[model samples]
Target: MEIRPIVTDEDHAAALREIDRLWGVEPGTPGGDRFDVLVTLVQAYEERRWPMPKLDPVEHIIGHMDLTGRTQADLAKLLGSRSRASEVLNRKRALTVEMIHKLQSEWGIPAELLIRPYKLDAA
Candidate 1:
């Protein structure tokens, strides 16, 4: 079985096709081994060439609110102030480290996502 690093888009496409062919192959067989290798190669290529962008912090908060049926009041309670929640949601103020800690601990929002660099409004 000949296999190579997935470098270009064409190589990636080829690997996907091979994966499709290998999809039903039984494990502990040659086809299954090839499938495993090809999947690994394709994943590495995609991660290098088309990595997912980090979530925007404010957008992440808003999306989490929508997903979890949370409201501004919930955020205020988490952050310890309605005004602080408003400013944070409006992108007018930066989130303090403490706020990040609380949001992660209490609300289960990931600290890494919450800690991304975000712009604050001009004074």
Candidate 2:
């Protein structure tokens, strides 16, 4: 197997295709080594080409709510009262450290995402 540094988009694409072809190869085999190297190269290319953004806390929460079909009342149970949930969702109130912990633990949301500053439109 001729392994090369993933320097260009073409190289990255070829590496990806090779990885797909070599996937599920037995460990300690030549194909497995090729799979491992191709995966690393693809990761390096992706990290350089596309960076992930830190999501805003409120927006993240709202997105979760939408995805789960949850409402302010549901968040209130996880947070506190209905008004407090509304306030937090509205951006009038910032999430407390305790609330962040609870959200991370209960809703499986990342605390870092929950702690970012976000604006809420005035009702």
Candidate 3:
């Protein structure tokens, strides 16, 4: 295995293509070990080169809604009222600690993701 630290985007892309070719190889085989190592290297390089933004709380809520077939009304029930749901969804109002706790407990979303500061709309 010609394993090396992936430093550049070009290197990262090349590693990904090689991983695709090596996909489904047996775990204990030579190709599989190389594939695992390359994946780790690629992930490290990508994280260093293009770190992801902090999870937007609103996006998390919307994603959860889509995943569980939930609706705004459901959020309203969890939160309080339809208007309150709208306000929160629309970023017109800030989420309270109580609301965060309720969301975490009820929806099983991580509190860390839900409590991160996110952009709010201008009033």
TM per candidate comes to 0.65, 0.75, 0.71
Candidate that beats the other on TM-score, 1 or 2, i.e. the better one: 2
Clashing pairs in 2: none
Sorted on TM-score, best first, the list reads 2, 3, 1
Query: Which regions of candidate 1 fall more than 4 Å away from where they truly are?
Result: 18-37, 66-69
TM-score of 1: 0.65
Q: Model 2, 31-112: lDDT tens per residue?
A: 8887888888789889888867766898899998898888889899998798899889888888999889988998888887
TM-score of 3: 0.71
Task: Report every candidate's CA lDDT.
Answer: 0.88, 0.85, 0.91
Candidate 3 — worst ten consecutive residues by lDDT sum? 1-10
Best by TM-score: 2
lDDT of candidate 3 over 5-117, digit per residue (tens): 98777788889889999999999798888988999999899889999876699899999999999999999999989998999999999899999999999999899988888
Query: Which residue pairs does candidate 3 place in steric collision?
Result: none
Report the C-alpha lDDT of model 1 over 1-123, residue by residue, as the tens digit. 369887789888888998998898988798888888888898999999999876778888998999999999999989888999999999898988998898788888899998889887775
Ordered from best to worst lDDT, the candidate numbers read: 3, 1, 2
| Collision count of model 1 | 0
In Å, residue 89's CA in model 2 sits off its true spot by 2.2
